[model samples]
Target: MADLSIDFVGIKSPNPFWLASAPPTDKAYNVERAFEAGWGGVVWKTLGEDPAAVNVSSRYSAIYDSYGEVSGFNNIELITDRSLEVNLREIEAVKKSWPDRALVVSLMVPCEEQAWKTIVKEVEKTGADGLELNFGCPHGMPERGMGAAVGQVPEYVEQVARWCKMYCKMPVIVKLTPNITDIRFPARAAKRGGADAVSLINTINSITGIDLDNMVARPIVDGKSTHGGYCGPAVKPIALSMTSEIARDPETMGLPISGIGGISNWRDAAEFISLGAGCVQVCTAAMIYGFRIVEEMKTGLANWMDSKGFETIEDFRGLAVPNTTDWKYLNMNYKVVASIDEDKCIGCGRCYIGCEDTSHQAIDLKPQADGTNKFEIIEEECVGCNLCQITCPVDDCITMERRDVGQPYMNWTQDPRNPHREVTEESTHEA
Candidate 1:
C-alpha cells in the first residue's frame, strides 16, 4: 500500500483529505465524527467576535440538474454563531483527544489589527496545528467589512496576513476568495505578508435561480432574497483554473497551496495535488453524503497510487505544474477529426442536430437502404471541436482521432500571419 500521509507546511496529517471550514466542521461533535470516519484533518468553521450574527431560516438554495441531482449549492449563512469562549474550549478539547489528526482553527474577526491580533493569541493557546485566515466568506460577512470585502483589496489582505503571522506561533494559511477578478493578486499579497500557505477558493457570489411562481429568488426569507455564496460541482472548473494560475505564476512560485472548492472524490483531490496543492479540503460532498465518503477517497487514492508506482503522496504532488502554461504557448498545428462508429450509433440524431444548428456543419444525416437513418461526419468540414461527441447520446460512438499534420511547432508570437511578427523578430535579434 502507498503512504497516504502528508506533512503540509510543517503540519503532518494521516492523509491530504481535510474537511473545509464549513457546516461539517462547525462543532466538536461534527469534527469528532469526521475524524472517526477517517478524515485526515479538519479546519474548524470560521469563528468571529460577533455573537449576535443570527442565521436565517431558509439559508440555503440548490441548483439541480435534469435528473434532480444537485449541480450547485448556495448559502446565505454567516460564520459560527457560537460564543468565542465556547468555540475555543471545543478546539482545545478536540485537539487534546485527537492529537494525531490535524486540527487547524479558521478565524475571521473585524478587519482591525487589534481584533486579528487578539483572536490569533486566543487561538494559539488551543494546541491547534495551525490557523486559516478566513478572508473568503462571500455572503453575510462581507457587508460588515469582513470576508470578501477584505479579500477584494490586496493591501488589506497583505496587512491582515502580516498581523496574523506576527502574533501567531503556528502556521498561517490565508484562505482567499474567488469573488475577485484576478486571484493572483491576492495570492501574491499573501506571500508578501509571510503566510505559510494559501487556501482557495471561497464561494462565488451567486443567485441560484428565481422562483417562477413567487417572483422571488430561491431560499426566500419573508418574501425577500439576497445573493448567496455559490459552491459545489459547478464551480470546480473555476477553482481548478485559479489553483493552476497561482501554482504556475513566477511571482508565487514555490508557495504552498491548500486547494479547496468542489472536491468530492479521490480523483478530484489528486488533480488538485498534481496542480501543486499540498492538500485538499472538502465540504459540500460531506454535506450531501456523510463523512463516510472519506473511506472511498482514501481507498481509491491508495489504489491509484499503487498502480502508478507512487510510494507516497509527495511522489506525485505538483506533477502537472510544469505542463500548465499560457494560451499562447499551445500547439496550433495539432489536428484531430471526429470519427463515429456506425455499429454503436443509435441514430439519435442529436449529434447531427447539434452540429448543424449550433456547431460546425460537419455531421450529416443519411438514409440507409434498410430505412434507417445514420449520421456521418464530413471529413473536410470537421474541425474536431468535439461538440458532436459531447452531444452524442451513445458513449464511445463518437471519438476524436488525432491526425499527424507533420508541421513544425508555431505560435502566435512567431507565426508569419501575425502583423507584429517582424517587430517581434527584430526585438529578439536585438536581444
Candidate 2:
C-alpha cells in the first residue's frame, strides 16, 4: 500500500497536502473543518500584532477561461484582520484538539528583531508544530514594508529568519515572494539564516480584469482598484518553473519546499513533489471548491503511487529533477514529425487554420470524396511543434511520431552550426 504521510522538516502530517495560509485557514472554525474534511494540516493565516488589517468589501476577482471556468484568481486582501490575541487563542485551541495533524502558524511582523522575537515567543506558547514566516503577501502588507518588501531584499529575509530562529525553538519555514527577479537569491539567503525549510511561491502580481465602464481594475473598491496577488490553474506553469529552479540550483539544493500556487489536484501535487518539494500546499482550490476537494486529491495520489509500484511518497519524490535539464543540453538530433490519423479526423479544419495562420503551414486541407475536408500533415515541413495537434478537436487524432534518423546523440555544444560551441580542454590543446 502507498503511504501519503510525510514528516517535513520534523513536522509530521497524515499526508503531504497542507492548506496554505489564506482565507480558508483564517480561524479555528475553518481550520477545524478543513482537518475534518481530510486535510493533512493548515498553515494558519498570517498572524500580526494588534491593529489588524481592515480589508476592502470587494476583495477578490477571477480571470475565466472560454468555458467560464476560473483560470486564475486574484485577491487584494491583506493578512489576518483579527487581533493577535484572538488568532493566537484560536490557534492554540485548534492545535490542542487536532494533535495528530500538523499546525504551522504563518506569521508577519515588523522587520525589527524585537518584533520577530516577541511574536515568535507568543506563537511558540500555542504548541503549534512550526512557523511559516509570511514574507510573500504581495499587495496590502508590502505597502506597510512587511511582506514582499522584506522578501525582495535577501539581507532582510536572512536577518528576519535569523531573528525567528534565534528566539524560537520550533522549525521555521520562510514563505518566499514570487515578485522578485530571481527566487534563488532569497532561498539561498533563507538557508544562510538557518531556516528549516521554505515554501513558495506566494502569488504573481496581477490585475485580474478591468471594468470598461468604470475604467477600474477588477475587484474594484469604491470605483478604484489596486494590483493584487494572482493564483489558480493559470499560474501553475510559472510556479513549476520557479520550483524546479530552486530545487536544482546548487545554492539551495536539498532545502525542503512546501509547494504553493495553483495546486488544485493530485497531479499538481505530484509534480511539485517530483521537483523536490517535501509537501504541497493548496489555497485557491480550497477557496473555490471548499474543503472536500482534498478527498479526491488524496485518492488520486495514492492510486497513482500504487500504479507506479511505489510504497511511499519518497519513492517518486524528486525523481524527475535530474531529467529536468536545460535546453542547451537537449539532444538536437532527435526528430519527431506530426502524424494525423485520417480515420479519426472530424474534418473540422481547426488544425489546418491554426497551423496556417499562427504556426508552420504543415497541415494541408483537401476536399475529400465525401464532400468534407481532409487535413493531412506535411511530414517534411512539420517541426513537431504540436500546435496543430493542440488545436485538433479529436483526441489522439494527431500524434508526434519519432523518426529513427540513426544519428548519434548530439547537443548544441557539439553541433557544427553552433558558432559559439563550448571548447573543451582537448579543443584548446589542439588549437
lDDT of the candidates, in the order given: 0.91, 0.92
Question: lDDT per residue, candidate 1, 1-431, as tens digits?
Answer: 99999999999999999999998998999999999999999999989995646789799999988998788999998899888899999999999999999999999988899999999999999999999998899988889999999999999999999999999889999999999989999999999999999999989999999999999997899999999999898899899999999999889988999999899899999999999999999988899889999999999999999999999988998898888877655566778999999999998888999999998899889999998898888999999999988988888999999988998666656666778754344333211
**Candidate maximizing TM-score:** 2
Going through the candidates in order, what is the number of backbone clashes in each?
Answer: 0, 0
Indicate the TM-score of model 1. Answer: 0.96
In candidate 2, position 176 carries an lDDT of 94
Candidate 2: what lDDT? 0.92
Model 2: weakest 10-residue lDDT segment is 422-431
Q: How far is 420's C-alpha from truth in model 2 (Å)? A: 1.2
For model 1, name the residue pairs that clash: none
Ten residues in sequence with the least summed lDDT for candidate 1: 422-431
* 336-402: candidate 2 lDDT, tens digit per residue: 9999998998888889998999888998889979899988788888888989888887999999999
